[model samples]
Target: MSRYETRLEDYRRRERPSYRVFEGMQELVCSVGQLHNNWLYVNVDQWDQDPVHTPIYYLDEHWLEECAEDGTAATNEQDEYIPLWISDRQVQTWFELATFESVVEVLKAAGKPVTLQMVIVAVKYYDKRDAYLDYDEVKAVTDLWFVLTKVRNHLTE
Candidate 1:
């Protein structure tokens, strides 16, 4: 019915989040970066937009619980902003963006002032399980499962 309802449904249906092959169901959080390229990767709520400076009063801790209780009614309590975890793959994307110099170009296109500091965020999902594990039985969830690289040039500094 509403966006929250849709997300809740999606979560309920998805027991596993990432789209990869894993040995088993292991809930983990690791700080990772790409060696080939420097990018900061993080896990976040896929639906939330880029982080804002101010404290997002819109979302509270109980917000997620509310969604769990009632998705359609909890639409207003949604606050999927804060990132849950970070990964290394995201750094690779930043490295690519930097190599192409597209990062600066993108900011300019969006009218966002180019700065030495930047935060890139992406939302993705994964489905990984062992051969013995049934795809339907193993389910996990992840948000912003991509790398977000930030780079600042000399001019910005």
Candidate 2:
């Protein structure tokens, strides 16, 4: 069987009920681009094996601990940039959920210029760590801030 076929069969067999928005939806996943319009993808095997696909964590270390309480975890190492893979649908949700206050708050929390590139990176990587973010405290602003932290971490500056 083809890998896709095998994975589909596996999905059928798992028999668990969860709202994994991107579960088995590999095609919708792509690298968090430097700009909102940008994107990248590769063979699933490459994503599984390549260190380059890891997120450049941009949050303060303490918030990672905070996020752990909310069930998101992350791993990364300094390397050439390719960007962490995330779900486009989840990103769209972030923007749809966004309010003007949310956007301003996220940008302020970033504690820098919060340029267009940074906002793009935040959107693309918003769902990198989980199938969906489950915590009530995680507003659009908070989620954006989390990924922005990843963007900041990844930037060489």
Local accuracy of candidate 2 as per-residue lDDT tens digits, 33-104 = 111221222233333343233222222234445544665533333221222233221121122222222333
Worst 10 residues of 1 by lDDT: 25-34
Clashing pairs in 2: 57-150, 58-149, 58-150, 59-149
CA RMSD, predictions in order: 19.5, 18.5
- Identify the runs in model 1 with alpha carbons over 4 angstroms from their true place: 1-36, 46-50, 53-101, 109-157
TM-score of 1: 0.18
lDDT of each: 0.25, 0.35
Count of residue pairs whose backbone atoms collide, per candidate: 17, 4
Q: Candidate 1 residues 13-96, lDDT tens each?
A: 533222221121111111111112222222223213332321111112343355446542222122222222212212111122
* TM-score to native of every candidate shown: 0.18, 0.20
